[model samples]
Target: MTAAHAPISAEPRRADFERWRRRSRLIRTLRVVLPAVIVLIFLGLIGSVAWSTFNAQPRAAQVGDEPIRLISPRFVGRDDKGRAFVLTAESAIRDRLDYQRVILKKPALVLDENGPDQMRINGADGVFHEQSGKLELSNGVRMEDAENAFTTAASLFDTKTGEVVGSGPIQGAGGLGEIQAQSYGVYGKGETMVFKGGVRTRLETKK
Candidate 1:
């Protein structure tokens, strides 16, 4: 009975020792591997942030603050008498010093377009005053309507009141005749033409 009991007890003791050894070996391997994996993941995160920061520097440096430019600009408005007018230009450049002032190239203006008395004016260069609704045209300005056409050196036109005035030499040809004068004013939607300053007229005979 003692010999049988010894073998049974020894077998159970051996099995318990084997189980403890396997568990200890597994614990040791996990302890070393877990710390190594955690260090690798932390390094990967740091490297990603460093790469992103390096690539962003050039794009940040390339931005600029510059003045605005316009192409083929158009402005439309109504006059005091509810007459429509349109101001168009080949190109317009905004003034850097004054935001409301625009420098126009090949500026063209059309007034009372939908009405029976329409007027058109063209200039080589112009300056628009936004607040006053004033247009200053220069460099061979030409103005025309249904009955008359005139060329002047310079003119100031008020878009709101539909009033035009020029103080320089002007030459004109129209239904009445050809006239050359030093100054002129057009009012009442061009129903009236007043010329001043050394006025000369050549009337055409209507046969």
Candidate 2:
């Protein structure tokens, strides 16, 4: 007869099966809980980002009364006689106190545009009175045309009449030759020109 076989115990196998069931239950619970926790965290982050994005917008600024500013300004209108004229400036500003007055920098005025008697006057600084059609030219006033060129310390120009009057010293060169005077007046496209107060002329003739 063979040696008596040792008996196998079922307790060890049963314990192993019980441990496997417990582990399977724990794994299923964790699978569901982990994804739910991750989705909740993701949703919280999305909500926070959306809230911050909506709150980060710009606000409107304050407005002011003088809102107009210009560069290379140009003005075109008819004179009193219905002739055309133009005024240009490197910069211009309307007077806050007087709307009719305009301050000009490096101002240039062209009279009788494209006509036989075209004239141009310019200055470093000027004040144009729009209603009266008077321009106060100062700081190196200069006047020019086809035949004449004049310069003075200061002058007054009437755009309507095409007249330039200067009480300060005026010097110029023209068909009559180089002339100097304490004061001068030129009317309407130089149809008439007069000089007074220590007037002097030099004949510049080229042979």
Candidate 3:
């Protein structure tokens, strides 16, 4: 006859089943939470990038009161009467406030009006008015041609009328002789020049 065996208890098996069920639930919850966490991180990164871009500063543009300068400038034009004239300067600067005027350095002016004589003028500095066709020269002004030479402190030339006038002490030497005058005027397209106000002259004798 076989000996009878004792039956095993079910309590240990039931406890193992419960532990496995809990572990399965924990794994399922973790799977759902991990995807949500990844989505949130991606959204946060995208928002941060967008915000930085919106707040970014723009690049600055390059941008002054400097006057316009010209090197070796020449102006040639005809007067209202269709007479031609030429003005040249070693250098010139446009006036900051006056658009129709220019400051000239080492200026030389030549006027030809289809006349018997041409007028030439030189000055250390001058102002040329474009609208009025006038030139005001100062600082050792000199006028010369085939017949006469004059030196004065200042002179004004009117291109429209073909006239030159100066006020101040003038010393001139020409075919007539040496002359000293308080003022002088040249008109008739530079054909006639007159000296007035304390005029004195010394004639040169021909050999």
Judged by TM-score, which candidate is best?
1
**After TM-score superposition, what is the CA distance of residue 27 in candidate 1 from its true location, in Å?**
47
Q: Could you estimate the TM-score for every candidate? A: 0.68, 0.65, 0.65
Q: What is the C-alpha RMSD of each candidate to the true structure, in Å?
A: 8.7, 9.5, 9.0
By lDDT, the best candidate is 1
Off by over 4 Å in 2: 1-68, 205-207
What would the per-residue lDDT of candidate 2 be over residues 55-173, giving only the tens digit for each residue?
A: 65322122334635568889887766666789999988888678889899999988887887788899999988989989898999999888899999988988877788989999989
Model 1 stretches astray by more than 4 angstroms: 1-66
* Cα lDDT tens digits for candidate 3, 83-143: 6889999999988678789999999988773455667899999999989989999999999
Q: Model 3: residues >4 Å from true position, as ranges?
A: 1-64, 80-82, 113-115, 205-207
Q: Model 3 misses residue 91 by how many Å?
A: 0.7
TM-score of 1: 0.68
Error of 3 at 146 (Å): 1.2
